[model samples]
Structures are given as structure tokens and as C-alpha cells.
Target chain A: MTLTTTLIAGLVLGGTYALVAMGLTLQYGIARIMNLAYGDMIITAAFAAFVVQALPSMNPLTGLAIVVPGGFIFGYLVYVFLLSPLVKRAPDKATLEVDSILTTFGLLFVIQGVLLVLFGSNYTSYTFLNVPVSIFGTTVAANRLIALVLALTIGLMFYALLTRTRWGTALRAVAVSPQSAKLVGINTDRAAAVAFAMGTALAAAGGTVISMYQTFTATGGVVFTMKALIVVIMGGVGNLLGALTAGLVLGIVETTVSTYLDPGLTLAATYTIFLAVLLWRPEGLFGRRV
Target chain B: MLTLDALSVRYGKHIALDNVHLRVDPGETVVILGANGAGKSSLLKAISGLVTPEPGVSITLDGHELAGVAPHRIPDEGIALVPEGRGIFTALTVDENLALGAYSRRARAGEARQRDFIFDLFPRLAERRKQIAGTMSGGEQQMVAIGRALMSNPRLLMLDEPSLGLAPVVVGELFDALGRIGASGVALLLVEQNVTISLELAARGYLLEVGRVVGEGSAAELKEDPAVRQAFLGLNA
Candidate 1:
């Protein structure tokens, strides 16, 4: 694939991946909790969306009518109930990261087990009114294009929320110093819980799209999770613009190589690029100054 | 007005602040003077709601009990603690940090009016409004910290060691700011190792040693006492 074609494909894919990877970047960036269970949690969300869509008279996209709210609720519950209790207002950036990874991985195991019991061991695809769309003469599967557009639109919306709103400003304020935040009457934990739910909803939303774009098994989520991590890592933590850039960069690279070579090796190339960039720019390609 | 009755803090086996009692009236400025381990810092922390106290002991702020009041709620109760080390948010600009202090009063009438009041108190801060707080000089950071505490529209502002490390001239400048603040009629609870200036700026003071209040009197009495002058003010200086 040429650069233009690769870019077009990459933009769509990158936008999608950015949505998925954003939660992890934020989790790692602020409190420094590593979310190793990124893939499994998302897969669980996909299955949940699948179950909703499977309802006798429901459209899968309409499942988003269920998934978005459902996603926020469940994600908020997970943060407040599960993760918030174990972590301090500001835990050690390194150790809690590993603990977060382990904890999420455990969630992955539990979710996969539940899915295996209920949905059985099988591949699934959501095919609700498949439509085709074109962008810059690029042929886009209707479902993928909508997902891509939604992912980018949401990314921008969050960017605005973070920069514009008082709540968002308080969230960043808590990010600066919990002690100072408290002095100003900002509840540090509430902000963290909100961030967790907000990030998780974005990830779950990615699950809705991924459910349609490819065949998914209860276990098919790990590779995509790793790929999303690559995008997030390259983008840098706590940086929405950087995440967007990294996601698109990964999208373009992976799409071009997968077009020319076997798609299976896309992960290998992604990991290689991830390591190289991380080695070159330890904070990330465009990480915030510490 | 503020009062602490039998206030104490224990860190496991270590007694950081043994039983201590003190009181301040409205429009009165008081300083607690001590050496490094004299619990002067802990006394301020206790008043600020940052330290745990022995139960049943009361820390009252403007007649409201504040012993166990949450840290964030302290400011709203009309007391602000400019904690030790000038706990300004390093990443925030001076203006943003100060505005956050004023946020508690946003729902109340006259918040913008209060913010403009702070800008006048610290003209240097107003001049460097866009600078990151951590990047500023020590005297400037101290001004930001004091300005931030004032932004809470506090009835009582508690300062812990505001003159930790600075030139004598800078320290003199800080005392001038405190004098202006006092003239405005806000009561201050100061913890300082610099005994002469602490007593000079304050109306009354207590001397602490090993977590206990060992000396108490009007600032004039303390300055005149031989033991206080010898132990704290260094009589010749």
C-alpha cells in the first residue's frame, strides 16, 4: 500500500485504536496504574454488547444505546468498587502499575470464564445493516467508517472537556497535587473514579466497534489490546493529542506493512516500533514534562 | 477565634505532639516558637485538620468544632493552613492556584471581588501571573503560598515556617506582607523558628519544647523574659 492509502486506512484504524488505548494511557499517566487486563476487559464489554444485540428485536448499533450507559455504569462501578480501594490517592508510579496490570489480568480471567460458560467457545460477528462509505476515494466498510468517525469525535470531545470544563480543570488540578486540590475543596478520589469510568467507557465503546469489524472469540482480544498499548505507549501517558498521534502512526504503519506482508506479523512490527520509540524517547514521543 | 484543648498527635510509638492547649481571639495574631522537634509544626497541622488528634479533644474554629473535620472542609470552616514547605502546586501557574483557593467561595457572593483583593495583596504574584509556581524564587513562592491561603477568604490563616530558607532581606519582605495582612484584621496562627520576628509580628506567643508548651505570654513579655531571649531570640542579636 502507498503512503496515502496506508494513511487513509491508518487514520480509520488509528482513530479506533486511540479510543481503546486512551483509558490505559490515562490510567498509567495519572495514578500510574498499569492495566494489563486491557484486552480482556474490552472483550468482556464486546460480549456484553453482543448479548444486548442478540436480543430478539434489537439492532447491534442500537446496542450502543445500551452499551454507552451500561459501559459508564459498569466502568464506574469497577473503579469505585474494585480499583479505588486498593490504590492510594497517589501510589508509587512503578509498583502500582504492575499491581494494576495483575489485577486487570485477573479480571480478564474471570470475564473470559464467564463468557465461555454463557456464550460458548465460538467466533462471533455483529452484522446489523452493513453499509459502505468513501473517504478521499478510500473504500470504507460502512460500519468501520462510523466507528472511526465516532472514535475521533469522542477523542476531540474529551480534549474539550479536559481543557474547558470546571470538572475537567479540577481533575487536572487533582492530577497536579491532591493536597492542593483538597485545599480548594476538590475531592481527589471522586475525580479519579470519574476518570476511570470515563476511560473505561471509551474502551467499551471500542469494543462495540471491534465487535463488528472482525470475528471475535472470548480469547481474541489480547492481540488488539497489545496493539492498542503500542499506540498509547508511543503517544505518551496523560496526553490526548499524543495518543491521537501515536494511534494514527501505528495505524498507518501496521496497515501498510499488513498490506505488503502477512497481517499476522503486524503485532511483531508494532512491538518493535514500540520498543524503538520508547528507547529513543523514554517518556514517549510527546510525553508531558515531569 | 480558634482554640485547641489538649490537642495531641502520636505516630505509632513516637509522640509528635504531646498534650498542648492554646487559644486566639478574633483579630489577634499569635505565633508558636520552638526548635526543630518542638512540635510547632504539628500544632499548625493539628489546627489545619492534617493531623490526627486524641479523641474528645476539640479544635474549634469560629465556634465550630474542627477536630475531625476533613482537610478540604477546613478552609470552608474559615481556617486556612499554609502548610510547611509552601505546598503550592508545582505544575500550576500562580493565578490558577490562587483561583482554586477562591473556588470554595464561588457559590457564596463576592468571589471575584475576593480574588481581586488577593491580586492587590501580592503585586509580585499579579505581575508574574503566568509563571509556574515551582519555577519561582523562594520569596516569590512564599508570597504565592500566603496569597493562596488568603484566597480561601479565611477568617484565620495558619502559617507553618513561611520563612524556611531565604535571605534576611526576603525574610524582612515576608514580615512586611504579614504586617499588612494583620492590619486587614485576619487572625493568623504562625509557627516559626525565628523567634524575634515571630514575637515581633504577633500579639502573643507560646514557646514549645519536646511537644509541650513550655512558655506563654504577650509578645512583649516574651521578648523581655531573660530565658526566652537567651533560648530563642539570641539576646545580643
Candidate 2:
């Protein structure tokens, strides 16, 4: 009974982790950039939420409402301002990816440092609304449940965006062949900027939702980032369905370990599972690992 | 009509094209022939705005002078290149690949017409519309490339080695399709290494040697040139 409960709880939490990984997968998949700052950018989003909480006019969730779209715009600017300049000099995929990783790492360090300086080091927790609901004989946290719903919804929306819409088609075309897309009059630079922004915005949204459920610090992004990379690799780069299944798998595993052993061992178990999955079947659950 | 007046391109100190000049009047077919390092691909790239030429070396499309226009605007200028190596969006499905070709606002306006035209032109594309382009045969992908270019409704179409590495039968079919396209009034600029076939298919042709126009004439005139026959057509010099 305890195991089942743990599994259920873990699955819900895993849904949130999937949300975190979506952005990572998107940027990596389309642009072929690692997006190292994606995790830290979430930390930036969390801080943005904290600022909203401190304000008299808003709560944390409302702050997220304001910040989510803004985060996308901000992310777009980051790609345009920071990443675009480097892309010009890079002619191949490997070099562009390396440059993106280095640049994102620099960006992540700067963002985390700024937050630490402004907010101090103590962990902060806040909830816009906390309402519990019973589901299939189990009590589910409203925020986790909400995160699960929003994560899946956004993930699906993201998939639809890439596949169905004209803008999505243009983006996918750019991802596949920038030269051909341009020859047909698709603005590849604009497409790259948009994809980068959208991916980063999801990172912000993930941070906003996850922060509401638990305490967070200036340093939580790296952890979240690692978890996201695991999910992305497991799911497959640029593969939406792959991320979802991988997210659920990671969730179930973490919850099961926490239930059976010590909470301290959860990280180890997660890593163990990640390595095992990686070694046994590198393509992840549904995605091709490479 | 499109004209390149002394267009020159360089990679560092190395010259890719050296003050090369050519002209393609509206509703005409012209072929550029060359060896491996003969700057044939660079010429197409320059005209498409993928590479910039030195100052005073100009590309004029209907006399607008496309000196620094970006790649996205090239199609809007009534010019589209079916680039060498069949640059199809392999990860996308066939329909998605064709749909993306309608990126220009003008192209988008008559998308249905373009789609219908493509379906008629390449029936195989319509049959495998949902399949990923990467999974298709080489000849089929080339058809998709040409069909995608046509969706933009370009007045001037440039094909860079459309027959590269394909079987002779596939090349024959492609040229036959090209003849149909030429008859439809779209000016064609063909870059090819297959000297005899290109000249045979084209109304007029330019033979390029290290980025310079070494020979230019009507197909029949060039075919009769003793020097041309030896150098390009594998006849005795």
C-alpha cells in the first residue's frame, strides 16, 4: 500500500520534472544547443515569482502569470543578444553546440549570482493556492496535480506547435534544413530566435509551477537541469512524446526509491536508473539518445 | 530578367568567383558548366544572396540591384534555387516539406494553387505526403526539392546540379520535367558538370573555367565548336 502511494506521489512529481525537461529537449532538439542556462533561468523565474509575492498587488501564481510570457520574450532576447552573435561565425553543428553550451553556462552563472546577491541564501517557499483533492483513493497535492495537467497540456501544445501550425512547420523546416528554408524565404534567424525563446519560456513556466510546490534556492536550477537532461535524453531530443514517458518513468523510480529506502538515497537512485537506462538502451524510453 | 555584372566572390584571399558576368532573360534556359572547383555552386549561392559579392560587382533582378538582400527575401524577388545535393528538409513529412516552400507572403496567398500544381507535377509526393522526406528515394527527394521551389512561384528558377549522383534514367526524367518547366515560361539557370546533356537541353549555355566565362553560345553553336567539343564534351581537342 505504501509502495503504491509512493509510486503515485512520485509519478505526480515526475510530471513536474517533465515540464522542466521539455524546454531542455526543445532547445537541444531544434537548435542543437545544450541550453545549459535553462535550469538557472528557472531559478531566475522563481526569483521573479518571489518578487511578485513580496509585492502588495500580486500573489506568486499571478506573478507567474505575468512572468511566463515575459520569460519567453526575455528568453528570445537572450538568444538574439547572446547566442545570435556567435551563430554567425559557426558554420557547423558541433561548433555551434559547443559555443551555445559555453555561452549558456556563462549566462547561468551570472543569473544565479544575481539572484543570490539580491535575495540572500535562505530557501524560500510560497503557494498561490493550496487545495488538496482525493484521486483514486489517494490524496494529491493540488499544485503537483496542477503541474501535471499543465505540463502535459503545454507539452502537447508544444508538440502541436512544432507539427501543426504554420509557424511550427516553418520552425521544423528550419531545424531540418536552414539553407532550404531560407531559399523558400523562411527567415531562419527569426525562427531560431523564436524556438530559443519558446523553450526558455517553458523553463520559466516549469520553475513557476515547481516553486509553488516546494522550497527553492538560487542553486536549485543545476539539479533541475540535470533532471531535465536525463528526461530529454530518455525521451529523445526534440521528441515530445519521448519526454513525457521518460518523465513518468523517472518519477515512478524516484518515488519508489524514496518509499523503500532513505530520502537521501533518492538522488543516487535517480542517477543509478539514469545510468542503467543509458547503458541498457541509450535511446531512452521512446527517443533516440544521440 | 536577371543579370550578374562582374560579380566576384571570395573566401578570405581565395577567389571563388572572379568578376564573372552572365545574363538570363525572362523565359529562357541557360546552363553553366564547370569542373569540381569551377565556382559553379558559388555562382548560384551568390545570386541567391547566400554569399555576398564585392562592391561594384552587382546582381540585378529586373534592375532592382540585389546587393545585400537577405536569403529570405530572395524568393520574394522571383528567384528560387533548387540547391545542389537536394537540400530537402529530411525530418519533415513530404507535405510539410512542400508547405514550408510557401514561405513568402505572395506564395502563401496562392498556397492552394501551388499545392495543386505540385500534386500534379509530382504525383509521387501526393502519394507519400505523410512519409518523412528522408525515407524517400533520391530521385523522389529531388522531385520534392524542385516541387518545393516551384511552390514559391518563382519567375526565375536556378537548379544547382539537380542530376548529381542520380541514375541516367532519373536524370533523363528530370531533364524532361525541366523541359516542361521551361516551356511554362519560368526562366531557368542550370549549373551542371554534365556538359553534353546540359548544352543539349539548354537553349543557350555558358562554359565556366575557374569562375570565368570561357565559352558562351547557342546550344548548336557550342556543340559545333571544336575547342568546346574537346574540352567539355569529351571530344578530341
Candidate 3:
């Protein structure tokens, strides 16, 4: 029964990780920028939720509704102000990637600084739909179940948009080659902006889900970002389905080890698996080896 | 009609295209022939907005200035370029590649008709619609590249070195497709190192040497020009 409960909890956690990783994947795929500040976007949304829940009968979910759109606008602004100039000035792809990493690395510190000024280093946690339900003789939190459903729904919607819609097709084209996308009449700048917005919005959603159960500080964003990076590396950068699978596997392994062995060694065990995967399949499980 | 007056491109101190002037009337096939580093590709790049031209250069297509227009807006202005190296998205399937070609709002509305027209032109594309573009042979990839450009319903199509690195039979097949494209009333601006086949396809030809148009004439005149024959066609004195 304990094993089953741990597995269920792991799955719930994995679903939210998938959401965060999906945003990272989309941003990297379209813009070819490994946005190191991705986790800050999520924490920003979480903090936004914290501020909004001060009102009577307000909840983190309500803050999510507000923050999601704000996340989109913020992401767009970031592209326009920060990323576009880098792209314009970049002499080559390798330079763009390097510059973007350095830029986002700086952005990470900026966001963390702002959050620290506003919220301090104290850990904050919020709750919503805290009801517990029984599943196959194992108890599960209703909020986590809801989170799983919501994350999976969002993932499916994203998949359909990428594979079905014209905008999605243009985004994929831009991802492959912005130059070719331009020849086909695609505004690559617009595509990149939209991709950033969508990615940040996903990060916001994942942050909201995390806010429901996890305690976070202003400096906590990097931890989440690092976890998502592990997932991305294991899944293959830009492979959405791969992210989902890798997230779940990571969650399961981490939870299983923590439950059966020492909780303190969870990260160590996780890193071991990550290193093993890196040694065996560096291109990721789903990625085509370039 | 497309007209380029005083078009120039410079990479710092090096002039890639120096004050070059050229024209392509409606439905006309024009080819620029030159050896490596002769600015033939740069001329097409300048017109396509891929490479920004220097000040005082004017490029007008049907009386609208193409100079300084955004690269993406060029297709909406009825111009499409099949860039060097086929430029097809190798990861995408053939059908997806063609679909993306019709991405502009103007082309999107007529996607069905354009797709059908392309399929009719290359039935092989229809047969291999679901295949990943990268897995295909070079000849097939080139066909996809051209078909993708056609899907935009471009008034003027530009190609850079379409014959580069293809088998003789494949080159023959590609040239046949080029003839069909010409017949469809789309104006063509081609840059080629393949002098013989290009001259046969184009109504007029320009010889570019170190970013300058050193020679210009009708196809027959260029074919008979002793200098062109000696330099490009390898004809002995």
C-alpha cells in the first residue's frame, strides 16, 4: 500500500515537472535558446499567486488565472527587449546559443533579486482542493490528481497545436531553420515571440501547480530549473513527448528511492540515473543523434 | 517586372555585389552565370532580402520598392526564393514541408489549389508525402524545395545553383521541371555556374565577374560569345 501511494505521489509530481519541462522544450526548440531563467518564470507566477490569495475567499488558482496571461505578456516583452537584439546581432548559431545562455543566466539573477526584495528568503506554501481520495487501496491528494489531469490536458493541447495548426507548423519550421521559415513568408520574429510567450505561460502553469503543495523561496527557482534541465537532458532537448516520459521516470525513481531508502539521498540517486543515461544515450531517449 | 538599380552588398571592406543593375520582365526567365565567388548568388540574395543592400540601391518589383523590406514580407509581395542547399526542413515530412510553404495568409487561403497544382507537377511528391524530407535522395529533396516555393503562388521565383551536386539524369529532370515552371507564367531569376543548361533555359543571360555585370545578351548571343564559351563552357580556341 505504501509503495502504491508513493508511486501515485511520484506520478502527480511528474505531471507538473512535465509541464515545466514542456515550456523549456518549446522555448529551446523554437528559439534554440537554453533559457536558464525558465524556473524564475514559474516562481514569479507562484509569487503572483501568493500576493493575490490575500483577498477574502481568494485562492492560488485565481492568481494562476491572472498570472498566466501576465506570463505571456512578460515573455513577449523579454523577447522584444532582450532576446531579439541578441538574435539580430548574432553572427552564427553557436554564438546565439552561447549568448542566450549567458543572457538568461543573468536574467535568472535579476528575477531572483527582484523576488527576494519583494518576498524575502522565507519559504511560502499555499493549498487548494486539499481533499484526499482513495485510489486502489492507496490514498492520493485530490489537488495533485487535479494537477495531473490539468497538466496532461495542456500537454495534449500543445501537441495538437504543434502538429495540426498552421501557426504550429510555422513554429516548427522556425525551429528547424528560421531562414527557411522566412522564405516561406513566416515572420520568424513573431514566431519566436509567440514561442517564448507560450513557454513562459506553461512555466506559469507549472508554478501554480507547485504552489498548491510545495514550499518555495525567492532563491528556489534554480532548483526547479535544474530539475527541469535534468529532465530535458534525459528527454532530448526539444522533444516534448520525451520530456513527459523522462519527467515521470525521474519522479518515480526519486520517490521510490526516497520511500525505500534515505530521503536525503534522493537527489544523489536521481543524479546517478541522469549520469547513467547521459553515458548510455547522450542524444536523449527520443532525440535523433545529430 | 523586377528591376534592380545600383544594388550593392558589402561585408565590411569586401564588396559582395557592387552597383549591379538587372531586370526581369513578367514571365521572363533570366539567368546570372558566373564562376565561384563571382557574386552570382549574392545578387539573388540581395533581391530576396536575405542580404541587405547598401544605401542608394533600389530594387522594385512591379513598382514597389523591395529594398529594406523584411525578409518574411518578400513572399507576401509575390516573390519566393529556393535558397542555396535546397533549404528544405529535413525533419519535416514532405507533405508538411509543402504545407508550410503555403503559410502566408494570402497563400493559406488558396492552399488546396496550390497543393493540387504542385502534386500535379510532381506526382512523386504525392506518392512520398509522408516520408521524412532528410531521408529522401538529393534529387527528390530539390523537387520538394521547388514545389515548396511554388506553393506560395509566387509571381517571381528565384533559384540559386539548382544544378549544384546533382547527377546528370537528375539535373536533366530538374531542368525539365524548370521549363514547366517557366511555362506556368511565373517570372524566374536564376543564378547558376552551369552555363550551358542555364543559357538554354533563360531568355536572357548576364555574366557576373567579381560583383560586376561584365556581359549581358540574349541566350543565343551569350552562347556564341567567344569569351563566355571559353571561360564558362570550356570551348577551345
Candidate with top lDDT is 3
RMSD of each: 3.0, 2.3, 2.0
Tens digit per residue, CA lDDT, model 2, A1-290: 46556876787778777877878776776666788888888888887877777788887667767778978999888988889888888988888988998988998889888888998788988765588787878776777777677667777777787778878888777766777888989888888888888888888877777777878998778988899998888787776677878888888888877777777898999888788878987766764321
- Compared with the true structure, all predictions reach lDDT values of 0.78, 0.83, 0.87
Tens-digit lDDT track of model 3 for A89-189:
99998999999999999999999999999989999887677898988897788888887887778777787888788778788888888889989988888
| Candidate 1 i-RMS | 2.1
Q: What is the TM-score of chain A in candidate 2?
A: 0.91
By lDDT, the better pick of 1 and 3 is 3
Positional deviation of B152 in candidate 3, in angstroms?
A: 0.9
Better of 1 and 2 by lDDT: 2
Categorize the docking of model 3: medium
lDDT of 1 by residue, A1-290 (tens): 46656677777788888888776666555545566666766787788787888898886678877886776787788777778867764346566666677888888778788888888879977785477666676666777777777778877887678656666666667766777777767767777777777777777877887786767788777776787777777876666678877887888788977988889888888889998988898677985622
How do the predictions measure up, each by TM-score? 0.89, 0.93, 0.95
Residue A230 lDDT in candidate 2: 89
Instruction: After superposing candidate 2 on the true structure, give the runs of residues whose Cα lies further than 4 Å from its correct spot.
Output: A1-4, A53-61, A91-93, A276-290
Model 2 Cα lDDT, one tens digit per residue, B1-237: 798999988999988888899999999999987788889999999999999888888889889988799989999988889999989988778888788888788687888887887787778888999988888899999999998899898899999999998999999888988888888899999998787788878999887888788888998888887767887778885
